[model samples]
Target: MSPNLAWRPIRFTPQLERTYVQCMTPRIILLQRLACIIGIASFVGYQFWDLLLDPEALPRTAPIRLAIIAMFAVVLVITFVPSLRTPRYLMIQYIVVYTLLGIGWSLILAKLPNGFLAGVSGFLLGMIFIPVLVNGAMQAAVILTPLVLGPLLVMTLAGATRLEIVNAFSWIVGGAGFAVGFAYLLDVINRHAFQLEQLLEAEKTRSEKLLLNVLPAEIAERLKAGEEPLADHCGSVTVLFADLVGFTELSRKLRANDLVNLLNDLFSRFDNLVEQHRAEKIKTIGDAYMAAAGLSGNKRDHVAAIADLALDMRMAFVEFCQDHHLELKLRIGVHSGEVVAGVIGRQKFAYDLWGDTVNVASRMESGGLPDEIQISAETKELLPARYRVVPRGEIEIKGHLQRMTYFLQGGV
Candidate 1:
């Protein structure tokens, strides 16, 4: 039998709506500016019409034409004012500009000889062009209503014939229908583009997170910045290596999934400790976990940070064992010295550390007893006086000279 699934309804939440608006604000501002420029040009250019079509009426119409031009100018100035450029203010400015223009043009056309025909032509032009400025069909309807009806009313009052008024009305309605449809189509296209941009942003964030998980944040940024064969040499660094005791034998007795689950639970706790101490987890090899401090160039107290991380890992492992009802122990070893760190590999690349420090740290873990935090003399000398340590004498390290080491017990 199939299990029942709960599904969330798909809709644009308020947050998404606000985001869409914000994304489209620049485009809206540009359109508003374009509209203003066109309005200004049309008014200025029609001065020739005033001279040609009806020179006698220019004296009376000039003030109305200048007034409409001044209104468009005011709105255009508002668009450049950062404080005044909000969605609400832009909407108000849009309505005011177009409404005043519609009214102003209607008055001017009414004074002409062929007033009815002139008004109808003006109405048709407004219906075809004005809707592109606003976003939705409803807003287009609101702005177009005044533009369409004001001229018709003026023409009717001016004694236009019934046939002339009817013909103009049909043309006005058809133009409005076309304007509303165009606005709706633009609205749909803008929304789809907004959603696509949002998806791309989300994917970019996810990819960055995954990259950070594999590499240190600084190294990841350098890689992203196109730094090829990235590497850095540090004079001082503290490295830690930890291995789970008895994990090999325990894995043989448990199922693969169970074994992995148990390892993951313990390592997750260690990861938290690493973060708390501000140390970087280098990588894990089988049951072993490696970490480092001072890779970010903090050479002063990296040893103490790694020491605190090792101590905390032991305590966390104890709690983990008790909860899982398993017999397990953590063996941690630390060493402080210079090393080379960088990203390596063409495919499946990783950030790693190399040199004597990392190897000595690994040997400290392998040579040390279970449930103990071991440190080389170099690391021990750097710890604060509050930490209590006991000498473990000297041990012969494979492929290296014998070195004095100590077991880090606790703070005094």
Candidate 2:
């Protein structure tokens, strides 16, 4: 059977995994300490009663007291020792040392004249609480098995009364069954909660990714922060607009899917070039692609970056048409000036530029020839010294007056 087709494994993310190890584990160690303290306190209080009534039993009680103390000291070290506090060590300590301690105490109690109560209580205490300290159901069961059975066997062999034997056996079986069942229930709940947390976290990440793809990172953050009327004045920026020439004619001839595929293929390449030059792709409207530079706050190189982007996009458009056996052309126009750029409208957020600069950039594209980079004079001045541009004497733009334009010839 293939791995993908096999049962899916439960995987916890780093945060959920850490919650179990770093956060939950320490608290469990504290629970173990509490359990030990309560057992010791109860036993000591009972023994004190005996001490006040009859001081003669101290000789036999001394060894049992010392054994309890020794067991506690060992557990204390395992609980707090930096190296031994790990889940694995805690489980091992419970299974091996704790079980031995239980057996040793039971042996001492059975040897005593009247010690059946103490021995049975100790066995039940360890069986019931060991599961609360360790994490897994299996580990809890492993620890409870020896801790419960070892003491009962010792009491039976040490000449415990028949009534005492029956009582010890009942407590052992009942406590073991309860501990195992309760631990498994808690384990199931923990796993279910971990899985739920992972799913919610994964969905949050996927939503954030989709938001970033739609808006610029900064804008997306602002929106998430509950900022409204998002707007910014980009003091000086460069905008490039490219319209696919012959798209109208090709749309009439090509099938619907074929036309969409062609457009998607060409625009995908253009998008890469825009990203390569650190430009913000404003939006793609129909067959027109708009992008800007300097909006990222570092305005010093926007002009040169947009120029490079326009050139690369021109080459990409040509190569895409050739690869797919189609005749297509890109008319790109670039302009540099101040403009207001921001996410506009609440229903559907669209990051766009406004002002004469945007309009002039659009005009440059409309007036541009096929397979040419038409640039306004503002952008032409900012071109690097190595770039070659040919001036196109003043042209009459629709709404704007006469403007000096140039064709951005190939660069060095």
Predicted structure with the largest lDDT when compared to the true one: 1
Query: Candidate 2, residues 119-197: lDDT per residue as tens digits?
Result: 4655666666766776657777888878777877788778788888788778777878888888776765666666677
- Per-candidate TM-scores read 0.92, 0.80
User: Candidate 1: misplaced stretches above 4 Å?
Assistant: 1-11, 115-132
| Collision count of model 2 | 0
Candidate models: Cα lDDT each: 0.83, 0.79
C-alpha lDDT of candidate 1 relative to the true structure = 0.83
Q: Write the per-residue lDDT of candidate 1 for residues 1-412, one digit (tens) a residue.
A: 1222112112368999877777778888887788788878988887767666687978878899899889888888888898888778777766666677667886777677665565456556556555557667878888777767776776677677887788778877788888988887777666666767889999999999999889989999999999998999988999999998899999999999998998898889988998899889999999999999999995478988888888888888889999999988889889999999999997899999999888999999999999999999999888999899999999989998999999999777
Error of 2 at 146 (Å): 2.4
Look at candidate 2 and tell me the lDDT of residue 349: 73
